[model samples]
Target: MDQNEIQFSYRARDDRGVFEVVPRVDGTPLTDLIDKFETDAGMRPSGDAYGGLVPQFFRFGPMEDHFHGRLGDAKTPLLGCECGEWGCWPLLARITTTDDLVIWDAFEQPHRPARDYTGFGPFRFDRHRYDDALGKLSRAVDEGS
Candidate 1:
């Protein structure tokens, strides 16, 4: 999530009682921009405690299920994974109830260096950012406006 990077904001609906996160980046009109605060963090392999460089990206990175308390909470929502694909670069996703499309400035995610292939298993995505998002949602709920 970068201020200069253009991202397509989308809200997922309960398609058959499931939250399907679909990215909408192409074919969208533009206008005066709004400021939205969304964030993400990445991981790179480090040592030989687990696996290797993970040669293949997961099919789906971390994402929200669009249910329960919020995207991140005690819920511990997973990040979108790029399953064994060439162009499967990890991404930051926003999970919403309605399909409200909006593009705005967001917090740039942390830069994670590629992990050293030392067979240290797979790298784990950061939890602090996710926890913060959940915290924001909780605060919104607490305000009770």
Candidate 2:
């Protein structure tokens, strides 16, 4: 598998008996990856962040201008607070798309600008495959609802 390849899977959870679907990337929980990055960088990992892959807010497109936004730019929220609120703790990244590829880079921890995420990712994915993965996830979520 290519290092830049992106894949998505769900990590089901029982939150006080209420089932929740958290997304996983390349078979590893998204939050775990963030934690690992922090640890590797000699920083204490905050184990409270959670993946927030809600279809509406996370679909492949330009995000609503928030922390780092321009009038009609693209950005995506990858993770949110464990308390289930996205704005409280978000791990955002700029998503740039081309004819045959989708690139995720310029990561930011909105609330902690001082913390650098320079080496975390610049994950690139083939556009067709990326769309397929997201489409599958959307269908699964719709079916479950």
Candidate 3:
């Protein structure tokens, strides 16, 4: 491995072969991989794909259920909400294998290792977070135009 390169391995649910989460210096491999599964052609497989999972990072608390319902309807997983887009909610990640074993919040920004979060799941949402998420989701679902 190049001294500058970092990688992690997980078994994929699809024929994509053994999944290795790698952050490329030239671009974002994780995002690209997610995009493939999230596309219409791939049909967005369940488990760890973008739409397959719920948003764990939120500000003020977890969003409400209606938000989640809308989230379930969302085509893209890990979407950046108003809070997330502005960098209020920390970006987190969870890694899992076919056996259901998980490495919670395992990813980090290739450049910013000091930050508490970097990428998507192992989801670790607390009660307060969930409540807040549900509230936000409700607003998003009900109030969103």
Which candidate leads the pack in TM-score? 2
Find the 10 residues in a row with the least total lDDT in model 2: 60-69
The residue-by-residue lDDT of candidate 2 on 1-145, one tens digit each, is: 2435555554444553322335455666667888788777776546655555443433333222221234354566767766545677877888776678777688888788888999987777777877777676556666655
Judged by lDDT relative to the true structure, which candidate is superior, 1 or 2?
2
Better of 2 and 3 by lDDT: 2
lDDT (tens digit, per residue) of candidate 1 on 30-129: 1111011111112332121111012123222222333222535232111232231212322222322323222211111123324221221121222343
Candidate 1 local lDDT, residue 103? 25
Give Cα-based local distance difference scores for all models. Answer: 0.24, 0.61, 0.31
lDDT of 3 by residue, 38-97 (tens): 353333232233211222322323233322323342221233212223133222343221
TM-score of each: 0.21, 0.75, 0.23
TM-score of 3: 0.23
Clashes of each: 24, 0, 25
Arrange candidates by lDDT, highest first: which order?
A: 2, 3, 1
lDDT measured at residue 121 in model 2 versus the true structure, 0 to 100:
77
Model 2 spans with C-alpha error above 4 angstroms: 1-3, 16-23, 54-74
Q: Tell me the deviation in Å of residue 132 in model 3.
A: 0.7
For model 2, name the residue pairs that clash.
Answer: none
